[model samples]
Target: MKKNLKRIAIVAMVALVIAACKKNQESAETAPQETVKNADKVLQYIKDLGFPASSIVDNGNEFVVEEDILFPKDMQIPAGGAGTKIEQYYTGSIVSATKKLNIRIFVDPSMTSMSSEINSAIAQWNGVPNSTLRFSIVTTAPYDILIKNEALAAPPGFVTCGQAQFPSGGSAGALVRINKTAIASNSFAQRARTICHEFGHCISFRHTNWAAQGESTATNVPGVTGTDALSLMNGGQCNSGATVLSQKDKDATAALY
Candidate 1:
């Protein structure tokens, strides 16, 4: 009887855990979608600055507004699109030219020492063809830089972490200026991945939605595919490190330039 009781207790505990997870998922789904909607607006505003629409890739979750942006219209919706058609922005342009990109990295004073790690990560990113980007790390308090510099206001809409600029001409360049909050929230590994991911955005790669290319069937997300799961481009806590580039990431880079 004791053994049977223990078995019942185990099953009950399992059920409780599943219930908790479901509730958490449900709660996430129910949070106000307003933040996401705002992020879409900011992205469109950035695109207006001369970047191709495909440049803003969404992380595959609700916390990131990019996941919900509607294509053509350039709008952000609820996560999973709430069963509505997923939206994406696409401007077909191969952004490759000699000296085509100039990237400036700004680190808060606390994050200043991370420069070497940042440089190492950027080097790997540069090794990827069609990247055509350059970077210089600057040490300063990021929040002060944004608040004090009229030129660098808060990112439009609601992207609270960081910002970038892609200017035109043969001098096409992208700048990634980060905030202290970003540094605090991200790990060393995460920082490296974030740099590459942002650079991926700088080079015009969109999220891994099967709908964008009109493929009727949904495929695995590029970097999240199977066990290989190596691509700086992949979302979530899992896709960090040298082994993260999926075949699709390679293809996307090749396609970009």
Candidate 2:
């Protein structure tokens, strides 16, 4: 009788521990779905966009791609694509409406502490010569883009840094997420460059060195094709790359805009 009771107690304890582990997992996996309507739709959307399903990360508010681009669950899925070097540009599907000159960025309270770095980023884009494109910070709503701080999952010693949404239709994508704490130890210039790099994504620029980076492919800007050693649009250089737009970077924006 004593042996039987001990075995039953051991089994009960095991079951209780297993049940607790499962409960914790469910809570961790449950992110607010917003208007995703059908869970399968997001998976299909990723496939239709030519992204591998394995590249998808189930971030709470949006889907992160290439560790830097963001796709909100509620965003309208783009209808077509831009073709090319398989590395530089996103063609028409990702650019802001050509006529929309100024992009308003509203920083989240969580990100406001880095105002100086954010301002430097805005100045770099606004200073792009001959391009009507401009970025301004606003404290109130009626804003076109929101910059927020978000913690991303990554392996130890590796950080996702920042993520931006590609413009769909003619408007600039609505958000940029900075891993504020991850890059806090970087110099001020590096911090600003991190912001600068993400904003590049908002306007449809791809890693200028994508081919070298092993990105599947990218289309170069017309009349401005090929690699730019000084390109600010290059990815994977966070906290240690070009701090300003290179001359070609300016020219590309001039040509595109």
Candidate 3:
């Protein structure tokens, strides 16, 4: 009788352990599926914003579109869906007015060598008349953005000067990855332009010449339209684009902010 009781207890204990293991296994399986599902939603959101399918690259953890704009897998999708105007384009999403007044940039140690360039870029935005947008550098935590040097890769015959994520959740894009080596040969003005351009992305400016870049049209800031050959916000002209914001650029800035 005693032996039977002990055997029954052991069997019950083994059954409980098995059930717990099965439950954990099921949870582990579901987590990846959930992640994949969320990623799909983000991808769809990107498409809905008018980025052509061919322009979107699935870069492991995030989608890289139009060479410079990054859409992270976990970024928050806007609550009401993408906006609809198309020219001198914007993402429709933007940094909230309150947050725009003091967007903080944290320079990673890897990027300290380009501090002058970063400051120059920040000054360009800060100096925009009739706009309250500002960017200040900080040395500690609690920052809105992090600018860092990264050895970005590219396909043959092409180069990636830098990359910036777009704004989400009512804040600026969180990361800017500068390919210092790639742009090292560019002049100081051009380098600063690269940084400034990425900052534009952080605050929700798409490439001003999106149509020429072979991208789908994007939301246009009210009263700021048409091609801007000298627009600093133009992409694919990293080493040769406008180093300072153009008149229309300022107009758009004033209009949006």
Q: TM-score winner among the candidates?
A: 3
lDDT for model 1, please.
0.42
TM-score of each: 0.42, 0.78, 0.88
Task: Judge candidate 2 against the unseen true structure and give its global Cα lDDT, from 0 to 1.
Answer: 0.78
Q: lDDT of candidate 3 vs native?
A: 0.89
Question: Per-residue lDDT tens digits of candidate 2, residues 1-257?
Answer: 99999999999999998898787775754444336564455556655555667777877757877788887776765555322222235534545544348788999999999999999999998898888888888889888789999996776787889989877667787889899988999999999999988888888777888778776456667778888889998878888789999998888887766
lDDT tens readout by residue for model 1, 1-257: 99999999999999998898787775765443555666665455444423345545554321122332222222332232222111121222224455435444555444455565567666765565654555445454331111111122234553333333222222222344444454455666666665555555444444343343332222332332323344454433322344345565665554444
lDDT of 3 by residue, 55-168 (tens): 899999899998888988878887676756333568888889899999999999999999999999999999999999999999999999999999987888889999999888
* Candidate 2 error regions (>4 Å): 1-49, 79-88, 94-99
CA deviation > 4 Å runs, candidate 1: 1-90, 94-96, 101-111, 129-160, 166-173, 209-230, 235-243
Clashes of 2: 5
Candidates in descending lDDT order: 3, 2, 1
Evaluate residue 208 in candidate 1 and report its C-alpha lDDT on the 0 to 100 scale: 46
RMSD after CA superposition, every candidate:
15.9, 7.7, 8.2
Global lDDT of each candidate: 0.42, 0.78, 0.89
For model 2, the run of ten residues with the poorest summed lDDT: 81-90
